[model samples]
Target: MAWYDEAIFYHIYPLGLLGAPKENSYDGVTHRLKELDPWINHIKEIGCNALYIGPLFESVGHGYETTDYRKLDSRLGDNKDLKRFVKKCHDKGIRVILDGVFNHTGRDFFAFKDIKENREKSRYKDWYCNVNFGGNNEYNDGFSYDNWGGFNLLVKLNQRNPEVKDYICDTIRFWVSEFDIDGLRLDAADVLDFDFMKALRAVANEVKPEFWLMGEVIHGDYTRWVNEGTLHSVTNYVMHKALYSGHNDHNYFEIAHTQRWLDGMGGSSGQGFKLYNFVDNHDVERIFTKLSNKAHFTPVHILLYTLPGIPSIYYGSEFAIEGRKEKFSDASLRPALNIKDYKDSVKNNPATKLVAALGKVRSETPELSYGDYKELHLQNRQYAFSRNYDGRSVVVTVNNDDNDCMLTLPAGNSVEYVGALFGERITVNNGCIQVCVKANSGEIWVPAEKENKKKKLVELQTITEAGKISDASENKGASGTKEKSDTHSDINGIEADSHTEREEFEPSYEETSESNPAIEAKMNSMAESKKNSKIDSQLNSEAESRSDSKGNYEEGVIAGLQEAILAIMEKNGYVTDQMRNDVYNNTHHDSLVNWVKSFIR
Candidate 1:
């Protein structure tokens, strides 16, 4: 399976994340990135396996205007520090994707500088798109040159030139080989040369077949950019616009129709195209600001995670870090966040919990990642859709109206349906499940029976593979089904009775006095975690036992209360170690959740 097919992306604008100087300080401040090591666990806690770190190379400002590709930005760190950082992330099962600003470069780029000094005599005169020594330019650069989107600071590259193409391709190879990075997110991909992109894809795939190539396509047919040889995926701008507009307008059909077109549900132009789905990113206003009603924010995020395509969470967005891109500057949107302060605030932020839950659910559930799209119901302010792979299915329903709404699902046994969002058993009557969603809320319902069936099939496959089951046994299993196992399951799940197990397995390592220091350290951490969990459980037992005997002990009551808080946090999002520390050190997670719930109520 493709690493990114089911991956959750966490986009971090490094300059903002690191709080680096806006301009180049040329200081070897590699220690600043030590602050980010704590966030690696936070990323994994939220179920994201991929980190789409914004520009980290030597640059002028914002890390986008590139000055050097071979060297690391002194403001951020040296190459050694970056390699160590990436290794740490890889150890935690996180794949890193760097920002590829291939289309343009800052005017101070080495080649551009060379041209300025040598004029028409420069050997690299043909490197840029429209360089000319005609007259003094606006910035008094002694020449006029092609700039990207009328931005004089960002000079465009002549991608058609073989020398320029080779340089970009070689740089990509260097990063992949040197840093062992997984992929690249092409900057300004919409206007990038199609031929160059195809060549780049070839190079990336040749180096590493699993290397993912995603583009920042804002408009037009996304299929044109994400075909076999060009890009694996593009940003889903169409849905990003439709989601907010549809919710604000109270028109579910708008998004429903667009979704159908993208998923090929109703014979639309673009079919089966999975684009990067996001409500906000580095370039736009925060989703919290774009949303008309604050109540709709979670529902919109729900859709982003459940719908086709990979879901990306902009850094600091999960906590409702509000900002908007104003006319002259994006300073508001790209605010520098102190890691400590952000972690402290996250413990009290309810959105963080919700986003974490969605991330975990989206990652573990196969149907959500690679399932067939089917719209079961739609209305003015309400919508329902199902993602089915093999027999396993999950039905997602959203109610954006002011009043609660009842949605009737497809005919199924009552015992089959389980609420993914709330962890409640669904009520199915007469072959149909009646799901009542709260006003301005969304619920994801997964069929428990189907999941169990898939697991059984996997077990059978394992037995078969091990030579424990014969052809006759396999035939017997197939005959036990209602119909013949003729249909093929897609990349998502197992085929009915034609089961195939695709479980991820890690190599077993024995821990001893001779074990590697890193392995020993990890084992020690795991042991400590187990000890803490045991202590928590014992405390809970004491609380319940004391409650039955006398009323309750003070310590037991506090422990019980902490457990409750942790449960609530896990239900909403995976509670991290930092959250737990915050709970024991400062405020309670339950208090923040209760406060948010009280407002919604």
Candidate 2:
């Protein structure tokens, strides 16, 4: 099991976190971070273990392209305040990770500026791409400090340059030595060459080993970059692909898909874990708006916090922020920290109770996150997987459809259900556990007392006595009590329940998820027979659009069930206005998509 399992990461955009008076950029917040412990405490109280702060260095556009890598950006606070913040986080047992931007630096950065001013004669002349700066283009006009895509501020660094390498390496060493940060998320890692990165990493790791160095490798097979000598891991952008997987996708399930992609990475063949996973980050539309169906974000949240890899909740994602284009523009998604209790009645808002529950399960129990993973079940509408760690285990089931789901668990003894997203203990009825789940809700469990060997037999006996069993197999042909039979030796001395003539029970995912062919047939029959005007109008509009041979307009609405889930899979982030405009035709669906996107981006 990966160490990050069950871990809830709270990404904080430093410029906009907490309760501060209205102020201009470069000005300080009226309140200090010390005053905001109540908010940070609230997050800790809710179950977050690490804090991912946005760039805090001097910059032009935002914090990304830094002008000075060493000094703290005054707009945020000073170096002293940063030290205090890291100390506070450590005191609370939370880890801190700084944003490392070695790929490029702002044009005003001292190293590159000095190089430009002195040409080849400059001591720092090798710090940047060596060329005269005269024109707008790189290939056509040969400008030295060419804008990335013709922009003026972000100048690409000369990683081959030794002076530049030393500066970048020193910056990394400072964070680990000074603040004792646990990790570094390198920004724009793909922009730098291999040799430069390996050398810089050696310097950083010298200060503190086991430093989590996750990189933004974006797309393609970046295996060479993610090896042990380089990055510890790379963020799953393939899962980000799920955000745009034809609209009707489950954002959380998409994260689960990243597991497979990560499985394919590195020198191992289907052997290792991916670096980490994220739905939306600072550079994209809030995940809230990226989904096919904006109405089912709660399930997505539950999935992200529980899935196997290190999952990051991009700064404002918990609240579902909405935005267009990438990072800097995403500032609108960042909201001030809230101390007021977030009641469940608020329509599209994330369930605070749900986050707390998922977090508790992740941190307190090692099995669910840090154990061996076994895929117990997988269907189009339901996902059941187990993580077994330290002889303890947790089984998680996620139902992405708009219906209740039942999974035939790993059978042995009757197990107790700890809880689902509802934040309550679960009880079973009939043949199935009979969990009362709404559509788009999921449940996670560990091997219940009756099933777990870690418990004393007496405790196991107590759980079985609680009427959790509906079978004769659990009984040893006596008081329906648990006992080892004369001829059979089951693991944990669990008696045969199947042979014991308990009343037979059957589960019905067929009745819940519409994916069962019978359910689909029933839906088709209902469509042909029913006379509801509302659904018929939608069908008619869909039919008419398909019939339009000219294709004058783009029919952006997801056409099938997958599209439906994809539309709302992720809550929102990185969605361009073009994609949004293309996804739906009606105002109501659009509003729902936008609102749901706002909650998690």
Candidate 3:
């Protein structure tokens, strides 16, 4: 398995982290990059092993529109300074992942500029998209070219050109060979060509077989870019929105459905394909602003860590640093911060302690990394799920409601459970465990005693035999136990009489006598159904990855809805915040689309 499978990421917008100006300085200062050395311990303390540093390359502005691929951005440091910084990170047992903005380049990029100056005669004219000398240019360069997302300064590259592809591949190889980086987060990967992405993956694998390639895919089916020929993973924007919306709307069903649908999309392992999950990044508002209540932070962190993905925390988020993205500027979202700044902000904040504790829990738990997900129960403001691996299970329960809620676990083996957050001991009786989760809080429960290896072997054999013997196997056992239905004895060679007491534990179902073999048999049948459900869940999860057409259709519907909203806004002559909120909080996308269609008609 790749190290990223178990790794937790800490994302840093380097230019913002180092206090570099938004515009290029070309000052050639290296000292700002070194300030990260002191923060290495701070990163490790929160259980993050991977550092995803965004855009340290030479750029004209914001590091997205790159001018040079070979040199470091002069505003931050030189090549040597980066090498030293990377060395320090490696020495401290932290892996580095750089932001690869290969989709576009700045207008000042040498090759693009050459095409502009030389026009039709330039040999590098084909390096850019739609370079035409036939029309007047936006920048008055005597030619027109395609810019990324209508941004004239950010020129899109033509990867179809052999020379351009070769240049990008060589740049990737140079970074791997020189800095020994662990991974690359491809910027604007949604618009990037699939063939180019495959080639990029092959090149990165050739340099380092385990070199992770993640994409910045905001919409569409994630499996389109995360399958075998493309990237290792993509940003889990679906879950990101579901997460905050579930809290904001006080509807856990929204997120629960998303989790159930996507959790099994991770191939045969059903690990959900290791999405790069985050609550906030440089592109969005901070979690503090996203969440309606501050108390929901703990439960949100709990869900983030326990969900099937490689979770990440934006810089300063662990300490509740809040920032919102303005309409036309990202300056508020990505701010420069020193150690003193983080130190002062973290003081007296419970968010750090809560996030750190949750991070450590995720790091130590195997189920969180590679287990199959099965949502047990869900309501508008409460949810429960299980992560089971090799017969061991971890059950998670969350109550987003303002009042305490009691959850009755499905009937199963009588076992003990320990809360991952507080180490509180809980005992199960008659295959059922009931617990009350506090309002706006959650708990992670792990089996206190490991299952018996021999018993597991027996259960597997018995289940397989049941597939063939059908009712005979169950009948034979029933016949033997029928006479002693009133006696407490071994059923199927497993203990059935050990009961743990808790006055606080309330049973949702009616109590049955310990001597009732009929009740025991019924419970055992339910257990078998639960076991079959696990197998079905695994199959469903694998099938989920292959069902991309449905996702594509859904995306089309969403696009249509957005267009309808825009048209309506244009016609109405006013757009209110309530209308925006309605659009956002509408979990039933198709219903909203139909409503808009009717209103427009």
Candidate 4:
């Protein structure tokens, strides 16, 4: 597995993580990473390996406005305090990654202040963007220099300006060399040019070669940033969009679209995972708000963790934080550390159980964590996919339907349970079993019985090819179902798609397709995420049933074992061919017709 492949990151807005009362929060607006150690420790107990802290460099409130490049924000704590926090986290095997906002700095940032006090005398006068602090004092409000779209408080740092580059580069070096930080997350990466980010990467890697650099670049394909070597990964925004879009401007089609994007990213690299996926972050409304409810957030959390790349949990999310466009300092949005409060809500709660279970499973099943992800069964929100490394395989299915879902496991009884991180033994009564998951819930299966190892790679290839074909028909409004499979077992009932899955996670309100008041709109603002990765649709629909039992079984069989052919041919990685395959009606390998007994009750 890639170092970050199985990594689960937890983000904490330092100033917002205090266990003590708000009166004892930040003296002013500064980072209190240490002051929040008690809370951070709690996150570790629950299992998080990385901490993505917002700007820690000296700055005003929000820490986005940096004053000193190397010093810590005095109001909250000091450099030593930060070191203590980092040391504690490292002691727990957690990596320390800071939010690197190189694109801009606080007005008091050395260069800007130097220019502010000594108009032309400062050598770095050109370093700030559009400063017209003259007689009319048009910028008397402050240095009018902006950050992208006129964010005066955060003056854009001119990375194109070489000297500006040296200072920022040195700052990163100081943090890594002196503190031994594990990674750097570049903020507003889209605004920064290629060279600037490349420079930052060079410096950070020099300090620690495996040091990760995740860009906050939204929109367009962020794969360019990773493939071009400017970053190790960017946020998985497509799935993020799916998490919030719900069934409004959304449907199973759009959600699966995001999964397709994720598969594409996974195929591109067998090393150095290139995506940091999450459901809710510091800036957006908490995941609970966007989901149908806290119950639904469970599936979304599973979606974030198991999907490709490194998964992250924003601080307070483990406790079910909820709100929309909350101000940075508001206690309601940034509540006190309260994992205990949520512990009950998640106890016996299937969704939370699934999330906790799968996160643990992801750690053990390296294939699921680090292997190639290919869709196997996707339809009606019962999205099923497999992650295979060498001969090891883990299959995952997310059932978004209200009715009990009976997923067929390819006529086999030799699958072992990897444990869903929490509960280990998934004792199915027989080869035929029934699963009852709330809408947006998932379960993963591992091959307990070994097949021909030589066919291992072949198996992966077949699944991938089948996935591509399925993906093509996804949004086209088609869904798949199990026909009379000779081997159909009780547990191996027909799987389903999102539309079908929605039966379980259905909204409280009726289909006012035009309006979605039923969805409890929390993030009424905007999502900073872009379409970086998406889901695929090789699945069948739970949305509808076949005309007859015989028709379902007749059509459910895989024809001719062509999966082997596709597997062999797919290795060449014909991305172009995969796209073209979607346009045509490709058939999958049909299996034995009368092998197993039906499971659906």
Candidate 5:
């Protein structure tokens, strides 16, 4: 398999992450790129094996308007600093990909400057698109030219020009030879010429074996760009939208439909292409701010890692930081942060621990990397799916509601499943397995027999016995023998069964009678320990959720609802500036709900 197929990517916008100046001053090198060394170690600690950081080339602003393709941005550092950084990443076994902004160049680029200085007589007049000396533009430079998103500052390139293609291809060769980079994330690739992408793929393959080429394609059929001659993958924006919206709207059907569409696009056997999957990126709002319910964080990431695609985590998102796009600026979405500030809280931070645990799970489980997708269960508030590979199956279930949910899913021929996160062993009866997923939580269940090899049999047996004890306790009657004390204490000094009131959705199991006090006492102790451990885990997770949800929950819900409505309207081409204003300005709960209902209809 190619390295990207199993790669867990950690995306870093270097200019934002390192606090480099937004505009290139053309001053001396600042060596700001070296600050990423700690982040590199942190990525490894979180189980990321690949890094996608870029737009490092010299740029006039935001790193996309390229001023010099051959040199590192002066605000970041010299080329030597990049070389050292890439070497450091490689030494730690992490693959690196840089942003390829080939479609456009800043107005200050040498070729563009030449066009401006020499007019029609310039030798590089053909380097840009639609360069007409007779007409003038917004800048009134005595010429007209095509640009990106109606921004004249970003001059579009003429990819059909042989010199331009050769220059870009040669730059790729330089990046490979000089920095030893592994791949490129082609910026604005949706508008790029197909012939140009084909040429890029050819050059990439020629320079290095298994060199990956992923594109920034927001819409349209991905097959057009991800075919053998073009690119290995494109940004999976369809799923990116579904992830946050599905959870916010309490609709799993949206997510399931998107998965089906992806499966259909990939053809029968499985998801043929490992499209890059992400919750949030530098261009959009952070997932923390996008999600209305903070508890859904775990489930969102659960799907990100377990779904059929290459998973990626945007920088600083793992810490549950909130960032939303302002009316005219995305500066909030890409804030500068230091890892050292979070060092003391890493262990206590629920999102951090969960991300790290998921990373470890993704790295260790081969099924997650190569498994075929299967939907075992689906509901508005709960979902279950399985990844099967080489006759081994790993099941993943998630609950998005504010209360616990009991999901009974098809297990096929599997007899049992072991929880990959907490080592909880669940028995399958009559080709079905029932799992009690906590509110806003998820579980990764590996077939018990397969998981057994990785874990000690004794420990597995102990856990199974404890599960049985807990199951029996659930069905015990009020007439049953009373315990010596009202509460049971565990090793961590946590109290279990402190309240007689059971949760509304707690499952009931068959009861059993134990005659021997010694044996029953031991089993009861083990069960209490298990229960206390779960309680401790829940407490930590809830603490994190509370910390993240410090703002008004009602306001978040209203904002999330408004965004969802706008997104749907935009998708349907019915959105207007007036509609957006109406949605944002009217904060009445009933009005927003009615608007959402109308859009849904």
Candidate 6:
């Protein structure tokens, strides 16, 4: 298999991540790209095996309007800096791919400048599209030229020109020989000429074995671009939209349908093509900002990694940072962030921990990378699917509702399955396994025989308390109404037997002492406290006193206090409905401060 087929990508917008200047001043090399050395280590620590960072070529602004395709942007550094960065990533066992902005160029590009200087006599007049000397543009260059998105500052390239194709092909060769990069992400590929892409693919194959070509295609059938000859994959925007909206709307069918449609298009193997899947990218609002309910962060990302595609996590998204787009500014979506500021909090952030767990699950499970897609169960708020290959399977189930959900899924002939995230083992009885998924959470259940191979997975002994199996046959829908049918079905809508006997299993906390000493100590303390019935009364008395002393606090102070309280609660997994109410509804500044202190203690 190709490296991309088994890759977990971490995307970085270097210009923004390094806090480079918005416009290139043509200054000397800055060595800003060297700052990414720590980020490269961070990426490996998070279990991401590939890095997709760029628009590193010289640009006028935002790293997209290319000025010199052959040179690194002065705001970032010289080409040598990039070479060392790529070498560092390779040393860390990470593959690198750069953004290939071939569809357009900035007004300051050498060829465009030549066009503006010589007018009709310039040899590079044909390099750009629709150059007419008779008409004028907003810049009053005494000529008109086709521009990308009607922005005259971005001159469109003439892909039909042979000279342009050769120049771009030669640039790719130079990049391969100098930087030794692995792949390229074609920008605005939907509008790129197919002939140019074919030529580019030919050059890619000639330059390096298994060199990948992915495109930024938002709409239409992705197969048009990700076939045998043109490109390997396109951004899975179809599923990207469905992933967030489906959770927000409590509709799993939307995502299920997209998965089935794309899989069918890839033919019977279902692994014939793999699109690049992501929750958010540099062009869109961060997933944290787009999600209406913050709790769905876990489930949404669970689907991103487990689904039948190459998964990617945009920079800063693992920490649940929020960013949204303004009318004409994308600055918010691409803010500068330093890993040092988030290092201590990375392990405490639930999303980051979950991402690390999912990365482990994806890396260790071979079925997830090469297996065929099959839907085993689907509902408005809950869904289950399995990836099977050569008699091995990994089942994934996600719940978006506010209450726990029990999913009974077909297990074929497998005797048992173990949870990859928490290492909870479930026996397959009567050709099925019923697993309880916590609210706003998900699980990856792998075949029992495969568990030994995944020794590095996070083994949470306390998750069973949160995932106790309950009777979901009469579970209510998101609207609080009971559903009539509870049978598992395949993607074809054929129902399986739902008459299996319900098994009652108590929550177990046996192995916590070895896996997690901190949790074991907390559990022991809770148990000892239960021996004293007077402890509850004493806590109630203290709470009443804190509530009684309400003080007038400014809104900003209250907001800051609330943020601190939540941060503490998040680290301890103590966030609950009552805690939210106490934090948000209480007006006493001293009470909030006490809560923070209590959490810290």
Query: What are the per-residue Cα lDDT tens digits for candidate 3 across 539-598?
Result: 344335433545665554554454454443333222334445545444345444343433
Q: Is candidate 1 or candidate 2 better by TM-score?
A: 1
Candidate 2 segments whose C-alpha is farther than 4 A from its true place: 1-7, 18-36, 133-143, 146-150, 243-247, 250-258, 266-271, 292-295, 321-329, 335-350, 411-417, 420-437, 450-601
Question: Which lDDT tens digits does candidate 6 get at residues 142-179?
Answer: 88777664345578999999999999999999999999
Q: In candidate 5, what are the lDDT values of residues 1-601, reduced to their tens digit?
A: 8788789999998777776654467857888888899988899988899999988999875788888998999888899999999999999999999999999898899999998999989999999998988766545588877766434567889999999999999999999999999999998798899999999999988999999999998745678888899999999987887798889888887687678767767631244888999998877677888888877888999999999999999987888777654433344556667777668334556677778878888988888888898988878888899988888788899988889888888774678788876677889998788888878888899887754646632111000000001211221211232111000011001110211111111121112211233643565555545545643454344445544575756666666656655554443322335446755765655545554443211
1-601: candidate 2 lDDT, tens digit per residue: 3333344677776644532222225444222445445556756866788777867676653566677887676655567777888888878878778888777777678876676566556676556664554432212222345333222346667888777788778878887777788887787676667888798668756877566777876544658777757876777665554433312543333434445444545321123444466777655455666655554455566556555566676654554444333211233434443434332312224444445656666676665455555666655566666666555556676666776765566621334555534444444344235444446666666545543334221100000001111232222221333321110011001111211111012113223422234543565445333323433454445545544643532343324211332233222223333233433322234333333232121
Q: Could you tell me which residue pairs clash in candidate 1?
A: 411-431
Q: Which residue pairs in model 6 clash with each other?
A: none
Winner of 1 and 5 under lDDT: 5
Each candidate's number of clashing pairs is: 1, 42, 1, 61, 0, 0
Output the better candidate (3/5) by lDDT: 5
Query: How does each model score on TM-score?
Result: 0.72, 0.65, 0.74, 0.67, 0.75, 0.76
Model 4, TM vs. native: 0.67
- Assess candidate 5 and give its lDDT: 0.74
Cα lDDT tens digits, model 1, 1-601, are: 6888888999987766665655565645555555678888888877789999868889876676799997777777778777888899999999999999899888678998899889899998999987867644435666767755433567889999999999999999999888889999998798899999999998988888799899987645677898888998888876887787678778787677667556542222123546888888876667877777777876788898998788999987777666653322344455556555546333445677677778867876888878878788888788998887756668899888878898787833335676666665765677678888878878788877655334311000000001011222221221232111110001001110011110011012111212244653565456445544644565467458645665657644554555554443343323345446544442333333232232111
Misplaced by over 4 Å in model 6 are 267-269, 450-601
Candidate 5 — worst ten consecutive residues by lDDT sum?
A: 484-493
- Residues 1-38 of candidate 4 have per-residue lDDT tens digits of 33565687888765444422212222454344554656
- Candidate 4 residue-wise lDDT at 451: 35
Runs in model 3 lying further than 4 Å from the true structure:
263-272, 344-348, 411-414, 449-601
Candidates arranged by TM-score, highest first:
6, 5, 3, 1, 4, 2
Location of the lowest summed lDDT over 10 successive residues in candidate 1: 458-467
